[model samples]
Target: MFLSTILDKPVCQPIKKPYERWYTFMEKNVEFWLPDSEWHTKAHCARVLLLALLIGHQKGLSEEEKDALGMAAVFHDSRRHDDGIDKGHGSRAAAYYKEYCREHGLSYDAQTYYITYYHDQDDSLGLSEIAKSSDLSEQAVLLYQIFKDADALDRFRLGPDGLDENFLRTEEARQLVDFAKDLLQKSNETNA
Candidate 1:
């Protein structure tokens, strides 16, 4: 056949180097969590990390903030038990991250854990209020928002029009939805 049915959608292949680094980190640290059913697999984590980093960079987040965000994205769904809604998964993932950091003698900022622990939970408090009450900087709040939105953008894995642009936190993130889905589809093909 000259054409394939799956070739209909555009694919935005992300730059290799940065994703390679994140992939390596996941392979080294989260091998156990990588293999799973569709919704919460390594591919999902990779896409979220890529999108979160892109948003963070565009928003002028410091390198430290980017690092934390990346870590948070990768680990956010690591503890998921199934594709259905699972409570306490985020907490378990955050605990895993802490133990992983400790064992590796690496230090992560508190925002990293906060993001990881709350990624799946939609908090009642606004970001500004949370930022004001906590020790988190504005940049940290931005990172958290980007991390959450990046993950949400991957709702394409759920089916048609699964990503709700209205919930997207930043303009950059909202604009990247199609591109992000393209990248994610490519990633899934490679992994499959």
Candidate 2:
């Protein structure tokens, strides 16, 4: 909907049921406010969702597991929509997930309050307070790793108009640099 308005692409037909409503709700609710110029927008969220779904599917997660990942991807930035400075965005993401589920009659197990907020902090900072086990596990710290990767892949536009490292911060983020580079090379070959 909004993406069609932004990109001039043909509007995507909504999915059959809850996904349709969920997407419509997201379109209505999410603000275009990007925290930084690098890449933060509804389009960015969509890209991450796509990537998250792809990864979850490729890794063979169950329907519910995939759903949890999807839930996380959708609500990841719901906080930034509120424009609050004191409440951290990730923590807000967790809170918003709870509220969104209750209001919409969707189901979600566990929560992300701890992971989103403290995922970036170092061990020396102290034991991170967890409100509950995350619906998604970081797996060798790989959930965050994958999430960071997906976000980077979108920001760097690795497959198409690709993103650069200017905005990427983690070692995992840096990994996508080569991916983008490889894609660029392949594109050059295809064009030539």
Candidate 3:
């Protein structure tokens, strides 16, 4: 499979049958700073997006919430500079997401922005920020958790201890542990 470095091209090939549409959309639409990044490639974002949607559905999230989750997933690591501890990548991605939405004439979702901004931070910090914020809704908090868990699920690509089920924010995510692993394996095979 030939991956394109052009910003206008799809970031990667679709990973799964059920998620092809989303994978294609995100791969084509989202902008990655490091298109050649091995760890934070478009395939990783697509898997995270799929996990987020599945977990959101299980949690009975509204269409709007799911949309936010989708946006959060695709943009979460868009600004990552390295595969290691790139601490402020989330904030950079959030800023990019805001500008992207504005330029594309899409609705700017605060929930999505917040989720993206704080995703790389500690869970306690994110939760506390949500709790203290006057503008953030309870739904935003849940979306944050869902997005975090969804991103974490894709950590299987990191190796054996990449994912710790106990760290998963939602029960739905915890339940998807085996499935997440399988998804990673299958996606790797497809990409291979």
Candidate 4:
């Protein structure tokens, strides 16, 4: 589920089931692409997706924009076969996204493709070659940051010294990292 809090204020929005359809879709398909590893579980993808939605909302992104970012978050690492620094996982996942979209008769967006393909690499704007090739829009760049920061915020899943605030992109994301850790802990407890 996407977060309902905006700037730490709890809003009265109802739980949007369709917003969660992305999770349902991925849950059914992830096993085909993702490794059976402790670090790349569906739970981790869920946390990253929810965090991306929260950050996107805080950045004033529209629902459609958030949905695109949500897609990237859920599918970004699905191509990893190993938990440890799988270098080309992002590219593979991005390719899987295309295949999934084609097979499912859904249209693929190039911006989402670029964001998901490079989510694990350097900062969105740090790679001059990628930046020039993608010709990313301002919104795409912001969405990329939101997606990357959201995933990074869940580093607590790695271990005690997991989350590093310096890796977080936005100030708001840094503020929310602890909350992400709490969510991870509670999720683990419940699942345990």
Instruction: Output candidate 2 Cα RMSD.
Output: 8.2
Checking candidate 2 for backbone clashes, the offending pairs are 138-142, 138-143, 156-162, 156-163, 157-162, 157-163
* TM-score (all chains, Cα) for each model: 0.84, 0.54, 0.87, 0.86
Error of 2 at 17 (Å): 10
The candidate maximizing TM-score is: 3
- Shift of residue 138 alpha carbon in model 3, Å: 0.8
Highest-lDDT candidate: 3
- Local accuracy by lDDT, each model: 0.73, 0.48, 0.82, 0.74
Candidates 1 and 2: which is better by lDDT? 1
Error of 2 at 115 (Å): 5.5
Per-residue accuracy of model 4 over 1-192 as CA lDDT, tens digit each: 333232233521321443477677777765545556788877788778777777777778887788788778778888897888987788898898888889989878776788888876777343443457645666777777788888888898888788778777787798787778777876686667
lDDT of 2 by residue, 8-125 (tens): 2221222123234445656776443344523344545655554454454445555565455556666676556443333466666767777766787866455333334443344233
What's the lDDT of the predicted structure labeled candidate 3?
0.82
Q: Cα miss at 22, model 2 (Å)?
A: 5.7
Model 1 poorest 10 in a row by lDDT: 1-10
Q: Tell me the spans in candidate 4 whose CA falls farther than 4 Å from its real position.
A: 1-19, 124-130
Better of 3 and 4 by TM-score: 3
Question: What local lDDT score does residue 80 receive in model 2, on the 0 to 100 scale?
Answer: 66
